[model samples]
Target: MRVFGMGSKAWLLNCAILFACPIAAQAAQDNGHGKNASHAAAGAHVHQISNHTTLASGAKVSHALHTASGKRVATRSFGISCVPYARQVSGIQVAGNAWQWWDNASGQYARGDRPETGSVLNFRANGHMHLGHVAVVTKVINSREVIVDHANWQSGGGVSHGVAVVDVSEANNWSAVRVELGREGTFGSVYPTYGFIYNRPDTGVVLASVSRPAPQPSINPVPSDLRPLAERPWRTMEEVAESPSTPRHTIDLGINAGVSR
Candidate 1:
């Protein structure tokens, strides 16, 4: 099995193609229908399309697709979770369970209680976070506070950007941290964490055990004008088509005329 790297543009392209193909196929079959029939079919198609969110590299991503009944369905995107996100940003490449990252890094990546840029902060599973969580350290504000970019923490449940993580541990260590949820400077739930995964000359870096295949480029490139689905709440197929960035094919997904992506 080939494991592809996360957060790359190639991955996004793959997602776009994955969503676009079925719509194209369905549109071909629906052609020649009358005006009212087309409208009904389109409405039915929108409902059939699945609207589910998935965790990729720890970031929440939506992979919406259409079904025959026009009822929306939700499916997980390519098994992407928090560990992959940490590996992608930190270049540590340690695999296995998210909670196991700390132990897995022994003799490979340096482990520490302090925060540093490019390090992976491993959160220990607690009552709230059952499987545990991992995030990348983007900036160190002071001894007590740091800024991080992580996936699956936002209320809408995608990627949370530039959030603050404050060390609330008693020993002044990073044993416990309160992460910023949505609002800037407002820390959310306090999660217990193992510590930070660092890459230093003394600690050494562990190469990934599994080799990931190069991502297959999408047959159609996402139009430059298209806005990322992650940026906003879920939108209907019609809304997506009406957006300025939506490709002609997306608009054609049972809507206007010919298909475009």
Candidate 2:
């Protein structure tokens, strides 16, 4: 009803506009929520991409087309040990096994649990990794994510670069890490780390040196046992010799008799 005697049609029209405005606004708000949900999904996809580091050409070939079948991806590089590779690339200058690099850098370089670019990430030895491992950090994406260059992680002393290392430790410390392998954006192994060895922290990404000699494993070649020693027992030299029966044939003891032609 109109209070000021306004026309019925006009009053109805005014009421319709008032109610329609809120309804339209609510519909727009609902559409906005839908748009926000789509944006959130896209953001999640981008974050997943960020988890993967750049893949090397060889690694790409090795890991490309891999599936969740739990199959192995073989690296092309013949053999590259982590120690020398870390030394040359990161310039840490430490020698010996990768596990030892942490302690080896004790007085020589600064060491810490945080990730740093160009620092040597020292992995602790475990049941699977007897000698441990070392890798040169090329980029620190965040506290828990980084890209690394190392040798012999997969291949026999084969070098791999631009691999992702994610800190999985409960304390947010880099005590444990999962390595992105085969350049396929797949993480194969989770390793325990001692820490990062900081020397030339500012050094940027360095390519793998495929020309460097791979770690040569010592080989002792022994001649094959040609004889079946079990079948033919050999006598020791200590057995005493028996002299000729003194001469039941002594007639034959004469030198001339022994020399009978």
How close to the true structure is residue 200 of candidate 2, measured as C-alpha lDDT? 44
What tens digits encode model 2's per-residue C-alpha lDDT throughout 1-261?
565567877889999999999999999999999997875554333212222233322222221212255332322333567887788887789867877877777667877777778888888887677888888897776565677777888655667655666665545567666776443445544567887888843333332222322221111111121112342122212211333445552346565676433
Positional deviation of 63 in candidate 1, in angstroms? 33
* Clash number for each model: 13, 6
**lDDT to native, each model:** 0.56, 0.60
Model 2 spans with C-alpha error above 4 angstroms: 1-79, 200-261
Summing lDDT over every window of 10 consecutive residues in candidate 2, give the lowest-scoring window: 217-226
Q: What is the C-alpha RMSD of each candidate to the true structure, in Å?
A: 27.7, 24.4
True-structure lDDT of candidate 2: 0.60
